[model samples]
Target chain A: MIEPFNVYAARLLPSQELFAQGHRACQGCGPALALRYLLKALGPETIVANATGCMEIISSSWPETAWGVPWIHVAFENAAAVASGVEAGSKALRRKGRIPDKKPTVVAIAGDGGTFDIGLQALSGALERGHDFIYLCYDNEAYMNTGIQRSSGTPFGAATTTSPAGSKSFGQKTWKKDLAAIGVAHHIPYVATASIAYPFDFVEKVKKAAAVEGPALIHVFAPCPTGWRTPSNLTVRLARLAVQTGMFPLYEVENGKYHMSVDLPFLKPLDDYLKPQGRYRHLTKDVIAVLKKGIDQRYNEILEKCEANHE
Target chain B: MAKAAPQSLRKGIEVSISMAEAAMQANVDVVAAYPITPQTHIVEHLSELVADGRLDAEFVPVESEHSAMSACCGSSASGARTYTATSSQGLALMHEILYIASALRLPIVMAVANRALSGPISIWNDHGDIMAERDTGWIQVFVENGQEAYDMTFHAFRVAEDHGVLLPYMINFDGFILSHVIEPIVYWSQELVDQYIGLYEPMLRLDTKNPITMGPVGIPDIYLETRKAHDFVLRESKATIVKAWDEMEKLVGRRYRPIETYKTDGARILLLTMGGVSETAMTAVDALREAGLPVGLVRIRLWRPFPFEELYEAVKDCEVLGVVDRCLSTGGPGGPVASEIKGALYHKDKRPKVVEFIAGIGGRDVRVEDFQDMAKKTLSVADGAPLPPFELVGVRE
Candidate 1:
């Protein structure tokens, strides 16, 4: 059983709000809370290059913005590339004494479609070039901003608008793309998997990412209550269930070494995670067994990597 | 006419190299570019300069042209004087971000080596690449040769970064015709260029001390207003462009006008062109004038604002006007240039009979003879003779 929540640990978090309130985010928006935590960790000395997604659309309407820090929203798929430019441009200006010498942390924020699919090439390129920036992907599983379309990040047996549950077919036919592994494959200095459910763990990982010199990527499992067909208040609970089950593992890879942040001795039942969301309402007993087998296998792989590194 | 500068300043250099050198002289803060065919030398030379410590700038060799332009927006928004170069397919790849760069009002300058769009994959010179980007709200200008290419690089930055006119600029020189060719260019000293263009003071930038949001989502209630604001600034940028040209002339002793004429004195017919072909048309004009057919030549240096007044003033007295286009409109009215010219002169009472002649497609040569033929055909069309809506000159059926 998980330890009782420590109310005292909440005092350790930063009090300043870098991401402003009174924005147009949906009720119980997981991505919005994740962004707030992210900005709190990075603090005021940060510049953001945001991609076109739910966070960008909600926070940056004309004449009013939710960002209290320097932020830019370029096109959909090139946030990493744009962040590369910002980092390089800032460095050049600082060296030339054109701007002040206070170096700001450069960050790129994108959704799952911008991260896992359309933006993969630019992300790969920025990573390969070793640009000095943090790439944060708020993964809501599907293109939630565009009315629940299926993305590569959408897991198997989940029904989106495009991947509807039908008579002859299961929902999504493909498994979730391993974005963390893809980030690791780039051999960046820091790569990690984060979830909005654990605010302290998420904030800690972001702080660790910001301390690194070279490229770092943090794939955030941001739950979308609107698209997930879960209770609005259960967004954080669903996120907790994602980690409590093996559906989403919380881990970090620092310089080729793996360390699981939250290593559960026994995973919760897959049904407890899947049965709450309408996206997975069409799953059968055999299909749930198949998903559970895959999740256990992947979780074991992570454990083995952590053990090997501990040796 | 301005007095010539000392010959010691003139150097024989490739047009692409001169453009890169111009960027270095302008003290660019960042350059993000991807390698494409005719535009490769500009970025390659820039990389060498950065590596050699001759230029103090960040050189980002982005993965694609889309990223190149995207990165340019980032750098420019960060208050860095940014520049990039690309060709036909690369420009097409960067088509989407080009509009964003303008709408967000980032002063990024780009050099486009104008080449044909690919079907059979010809890497030759044409206006097809720049034509496709006409409505992208960039301040577009065409250069005639290496010297103008070098001069306009500074002009592009100067006008683009103006406080009142914060827009992206594109300088188009033909792909192989100008980009690969060598010419005697008068290189400006670094100090002189600094004195001419001055430092870039961005009206707004991404700064943590004074944080601001850029490229926000415009809802329908305010989207039209945003578009109108952009259009207003672009239309008003003509004065800034002309003033920059005048200042360059005062410093470098080379004069430029929106519409440059060649021997249009008392001529009844005029051949209008843009880019490198204008020089050849000048020769055709001299020949036609000697033969007593009353022909002259006019070249458009400024393309984006359309130069409606200058063009009408240049060709209003002429009886027949042959508008030479290097690219076709495919199914639309003749060529893109001709269509715009027709639209500009549509309701005028004393306008010339606008005859569109499509030539030099995919870098097929538009020689002096070809221009001469176009002039005679335009004159005949003016004399109550039947003609096609637009003539595809020098194309063998």
Candidate 2:
């Protein structure tokens, strides 16, 4: 059984919103939950340069707004670029006394499609520049807005509109791109993988990302109930299972040292996580076994990294 | 009043020299670019300035045209008034990102050495690259000489970062023509530019104390609407462009208009062109007038907003138009500039029969004699076989 979201995450995320209300997001969208926790952890005085995604559309609709602080929706790929611009603009303004020195912290948010595909180059450029900004890539596995096309972030055996469960189909044939590893390779100030299943742990990673002065990236595994074809209420439960099963592990990299936030007692069967969601309903035993084998290999490697970080 | 002189000044200093010196005076914070042909001298001078500490800017040596703009984007977004230069193939490589920069509205300034696109990769002067990107939401200004390049580049920062028009801009200097060839340029002092355009006061920024969510996902119902709003703002922001130029005029004594005219005062034939080709086109008109042909020239300075009204009034009464286009429009009957020029004049009462000439493309050498050739070709068509305004000087089979 899953714990109630409000009761379980109270200590981690405050009731007050940094994202605020009135910004239009789907009822209980995973990205919103991710933003809620991220905002609480980072606190206020943070300016956001959002991209052209579901979050930007709903919150920034004219005459109605969801954000409590300063925010902008520049473009899909240029969120990191725009955030960097605002960061530079504010800093330069402060030095010249053109703007008050009390500048808000800049944070950029993008969905899986934007982060994993369209905006990848801009994100790479920002990280390379070592701009003091936090890039939050809320991975919902597929392009939820554009009618559930398979994004690079989508995992194997997951069914999407593009990767349909029709004749001669293996669902999404590729595994999710290891974005956290790529980010870590940049030797960024911070790189972390999180899930809404563990709100406190997620919040903590966000806090760590915010505190770092250089480029930081936080990837949150946000389950899409609509896109994943799962019941909305079972979102958190499925996400929590995703972690315990070693499918989407929760971990952080602190100054190049890898730290696993949760280490499971025993690996749960891959079928347990896959069976409930319609996205994975057509998965055959062979496909499940193959996925399990890859997951096991990757998990063992992660454990080796954890063991190596025995400080 | 004391310094202003004739439109033609004898063999002036190269525009690149004045551009380098203007940037030096502007006290730029960052100059990051990879040099392409035609744009080489501008960056060469910039690199030298940073090397000698003449300008206090972090000059990042980027690998490619994509990264050149990428570095500028990074540096500019970080609140630095960054500058970069590119043309032709280099500009094409930065094509996808040009839209990205404008949409993000980073307020970056790029000096574009306008060159033709490649099937044949010519490095000479043309407006193909810039014309292809006319609708990319960048505030583009075409300069005929080095003096304009010197003034426009500094003015770009003002127009781009203006609170009302927070858009990135590209100041186009014709490849080889203006970017390579030297001309007398009046260099303005930094004190005036600084006083005219103060430091950027960014509305939303990245800092530690305050945190907010940005760049969220926009769904279908709102996506089109949001894009429509952005499109509307870009088009309607023409007034802001004029206002910025006017304010800059107060500080520096020069002013800019969308469509610049030369002897259009009651002329029957009007020769039209953009960028450095305007000089050649004007020379053609002068020769035609010396032989008693009533011809004038109209130069399009601002490409974005199209300057339709100014163009309409400028060429309304003209009987014949020799519009030289540097870019091809595959789907349409002719090139991009020619098509727009014809379209803008279509609604006029005493409309000119516009003859589209595909000239100086792929960096092909366009001499002043080419315009004289083109003007003669245009008048012949106007006199008898004016087949509904179409392409003339194409590289035909």
- Candidate maximizing lDDT: 1
Candidate 2, superposed: residue stretches over 4 Å from native: A1-12, A95-97, A101-104, B1-17, B20-86, B89-108, B120-123, B157-168, B199-257, B263-268, B381-396
lDDT of 1 by residue, A160-180 (tens): 999988997788889899998
DockQ values of all predictions: 0.87, 0.22
| lDDT, each prediction | 0.91, 0.76
Instruction: Compose the digit string of candidate 1's lDDT tens values, residues B1-397.
Output: 2233552288898999999999999999999999865565899999999999999999998999999999999999999999999999999999999999999999999999999999779798899989999999999999898999999999999999999999999999998889989899888877668877888999989999999999999999999999999999999999999998998888787899988999988877788899998888888888888898878888999998779999999989998788999899988888999888888898999998888899999989888999889988887877777765888888889
TM-score for each of the candidates: 0.98, 0.86
* Clash count for each candidate, listed in order shown: 0, 36
Supply the global lDDT for candidate 2.
Answer: 0.76
Which pairs, if any, clash in model 1?
none
